[model samples]
Target: MSTVNILHMKQGDGEMSYAKNSTIQMRWMNMALPIVKNTIKEMLTIHLTSFEKLESFKIVDIGCGSGPNTLLFMSEIIDTFYNLSNQNNHQSPEISIVLNDLYKNDFNNIFNALPLFYEQLKEKYGHEFSQRCFISVVASSFYERLLPSKSLHFVHSSSSLHWLSQVPENLDNKGHIYMAKDCLPIVFDAYKNQFNKDFYSFLNKRSQEIFPKGKMILTLLGRSIPEPSSNDGCCLWELLAQSLLDMVSQGLVKKEDVDSFNLPFYTPYCDEVKEIVMKENSFDLDKIEVYMCNWDPNDDEDDDNNIFDKKKSGENIVKRIRVVSESMLVTHFGELPLDTVFKIFAERVANHLEMEKTKYTNLTICLKKK
Candidate 1:
């Protein structure tokens, strides 16, 4: 089976859909707003100032996943461009959008959302918005070259690049699905090598596609420290492993199945990202920052470690996880154990949170083509 077949988020806009559970993803995108706003202004001043408004300006969203936020984010970005252009007394330029992702991504959901999305843009910017905006899709992988040479301006992505092209070879990550405390040296080495290789190739490809001054803002699930096994980085999987082990004890899941599975996901440290960018040498690292959010996207735990209503928080976190992971998990563990494993996972998460607070850490990386 294809990788896309195995890795898509839950489809539809139902309660359990990525559309419903993407508050965390939206928050990550919104956190990049200050940088995004600055980028648009710079693009307007530097590039659009010399061009005819009738000419098309292209932007690409690499790994633009499904959810209501898919078009919502793109529309807001266009609005930013036009609004900033208006401020500078420039005519509106045709905005061409290229939405690229794996084959099985829920492009249908994104397509269904378009009428309303266009209406919202009309509501805000009127009929002119319709003429100035163009949207297209390339059903392919970012790990391969997806666009023409120097064909892109102001590229963007979020919660994407951390996914390796494939799972690492020869994982002996028995009993754990990801990097964790006490994970063997070989396991760590496999993950590190895979990420390094995939990421360098990704940069080399993207470097060719973006214009000389084109910028990319990539936000990913990542860590504040260099260690992949750190609490904020790998604790989520460790907890998931504990839940799977509990299931094994109950005979609800096979011990061997639990032992052999490992996620194709990695959350890199800021320094790790810096080294890769430096090694690639195709882009200048403008800014890279680490930010933390509560594991429960909706958690208002405030400045303290207080997690009131632990059970509710646990459900929230697990539901968020389920939307992203359910398909691959069901394929590996079968549909029957789905609810049971997740229920156990939620309980484990609540208990773990009760002991101490752990926030999800992420990296927002900004780059300029060199």
Candidate 2:
């Protein structure tokens, strides 16, 4: 299925909405903020030390999912400039922040919150300063160019790029929604090839939109090793697959339905990312770092590695996955079996965690246009 049409986060701001279930993405956003702040400081010192020539500092947050985080980054950027100007006595430049996401994403929530957010900004930096900040939301696919040439200053994205434009054409990945330990080599190759193609297009298009020397910081699901079926890569999916198979045994779902499903996602190795940037030749790979997030987002105590409550941990993990994947699953599996399937999935996740703890590795890559 095409992600452009069929894929989206569960919409609205209710308990089950993506809005309420995005703590993991928010965590990554916080982790990447220091990098963003330092880059903004560097840009001020060199490129836009003075806004005499450049009137506005323009930024686009590609795949900026709707939620509390929608405006959090933008607010931080404004504060960065506000603080710098106060400390250095530099003139504050007008700022523009664009939020880009798939058309199916729920944008109304963002629209509703803008007025109050703007009001709060007015209190922080005064009315005139707030007036200089512009906010726009665009519904479009990032695989294609969604901005004018040489118009952007910086780009930021988190928890977005791992989704391919679509499921690879003619994939025969049966009995699994994603690459698993027993997945065939042919299936793995198809996924890798699709990621290469999609990422190349992404870079080529960004090269057209961003000004020379502009930078982008992207955070997405990734793997530490080259193997696609490794623990950090596919263990979560394998557990979910086990849940589906259990339902198959109960006749709750068709075996054929389970067999035909495959996700439009891929987590690449650091080497794979390096190779792609070199091949594209449009961006300089500045740095790549990996951070391990537990399958349970709430599990953050470094000294505590034990799962005291396996059932709660499993439920927490499934909530995160469900907010993001529910749309696609409903499109493919119908609504009747979703609750039951996910209940079983949570149980399987709990059982799996009892034996071993696994994490999702996120790769944060920094790139600058060459």
Candidate 3:
């Protein structure tokens, strides 16, 4: 029998183009993704510490955006061996890691960045570093990608799975009601439908490909409190979208186009995730927790503003947020003139968020293969 549990996975559709240019935005993610990676890594460490049976393992990183988290794991593995060597005078256990994500991701960027990470390792541990490291990047989707059965030991992804290739065809974002009550169900349903279809397929495929004792650690944007009617308490995605709409009135974009643009996709609460993962009955629940991400220190807890003022002092914060947010938007809205559109979008989001308090609520899960 297979045991399965869902904590939280998808938060919103992923935007791809964000990290391509701005080092500042990329740096911000460096802080965010690592925190997420460390949290999951601690979970994995705790689980591994109790396992009496140990062997060389293969690590698979899904949706390895920029490969930061993948490298982080590698760093952890190296630390594990180094600590062991210091204690018992033994070499680290041999491990191989593979990085996988959509073909469009900045693999070259990752490759270019590798020298720096490798240098850090070599500087710390000398020649022993290169001999133990095996890293490869695979460009493909989680469902259709090919891998040998029972070949992987650990699988991981962060902030990447929520994006569906496209928004559901039936979604209508321009409805008259703008309150949380009116907006909640439509988006949630779209997200739930997409995840059930794709994520189910992903799990079934993995069930065939991974060994019985392997494990997966996944962290995604989530809602700590269920939003049956509105998007409050959800991740910061909707706030980003509202920022984009602010550009329309400023001659940067058209209102009709903004209305037509729905967030790419996301999934529902933990139970919904469990329904999909449990299909093959091959996974065991280990840990599931929800935490918040991305915060504005100046926000007021009880105010709402519809228009973002791009001209405000410190509004430059949009540039940092824009790295990922605009990247995804440009990928989808490329036809629109970027300079004009982004100017309006930034100004609007700044103004709109001037009075609202928000945080990123995320779901983190760790599962052991049965």
Off by over 4 Å in 1: 1-21, 47-54, 303-307
Candidate 3: residue 147 lDDT (0-100): 79
lDDT score of model 1? Answer: 0.74
What TM-score does candidate 1 reach?
Answer: 0.91
Q: Can you rank all candidates by TM-score, best first? A: 2, 1, 3
User: What digit string (tens of lDDT, one per residue) describes model 3 on residues 1-370?
Assistant: 1211111121122323224214332333443455444543453356444222334445555566663544664576556556655554544544556666666676787788778877887788776745665667766666553477766555655565555555666777662112134465665566567767777766767677666766666665555555533343333445455555666656676677667666554634666666667775788776666664434423333457633333542245455555555655665567766555456545555555565544555565666678
Q: What lDDT score goes with residue 40 in model 1? A: 65
* RMSD (Å) per prediction: 5.8, 5.6, 6.4
The residue pairs found clashing in candidate 2 are none
* Overall local distance difference test of candidate 2: 0.76
**Residues 1-370, model 2: lDDT tens digits:** 0000001111121112222356886788788889978976776678543534445676666565668776776788789878976787665767776766767667787888899999999998999889988888777778877777776656676776787888888999788989988888999999999999988988888788777777878778899788889888998888888888888899888889888888888999999999999999999999998998888878765656754689999998998888777876776778547788789989988998899888889888898888
For candidate 1, list the clashing residue pairs, or say none.
none
Worst 10 residues of 1 by lDDT: 1-10
**How many clashes in each structure?**
0, 0, 14
Ten residues in sequence with the least summed lDDT for candidate 2 = 1-10
Off by over 4 Å in 3: 1-55, 67-70, 175-181, 184-187, 228-236, 239-246, 297-317, 335-354
User: What's the candidate order when arranged by decreasing lDDT?
Assistant: 2, 1, 3
